[model samples]
Target: KKLSRFGVRSKDYYLYLFFKRAHKSFTLLFGCLLPLFFNAICSVITFGLLFLEKQFRLLDILFQIIIGQ
Candidate 1:
């Protein structure tokens, strides 16, 4: 009832309702997906480092492995 004071008509009121529903779902979806996004980025970086490490000399790789132990 108070919505009419701002000139919001009955027909366009559904648009506002739709946005209210969409905003809640969007927030929930973003919260759920954020961790997966971070994990994917970390995995990509780890794989890249491994690939670069493979390009080094075999002796260097062995040295690194020995030092890591």
Candidate 2:
């Protein structure tokens, strides 16, 4: 097996580089956006529940607060 100057085999070095790139992209995509995505999902669910549940009147109160009525 041919080894690179770093003493690691060429295939191993390529795999290491590939993993590093994948990890960086994964961190950027999931780490930064995962929480925001979850928060948005929760907000949508809560809003839908409030709007659909007339007994709560939370959505009605929110509309009143926004329209100042």
User: Which run of 10 residues does model 2 get worst, by summed lDDT?
Assistant: 1-10
TM for every model, in the order presented, reads 0.55, 0.55
User: What is candidate 1's lDDT per residue for 1-69, written digit by digit as tens?
Assistant: 686755666556788889988998999999899989999999999999888877666768788899995
Q: Write the per-residue lDDT of candidate 2 for residues 11-66, one digit (tens) a residue.
A: 68799999999999999999889999999999999999877897558877988899
Q: Over 4 Å off in model 2, which ranges?
A: 1-8, 55-69
Best lDDT among the predictions, by candidate number: 2
The deviation in Å at residue 15 for candidate 1 is 2.9
Model 1 misplaced regions, further than 4 Å: 1-13, 59-69
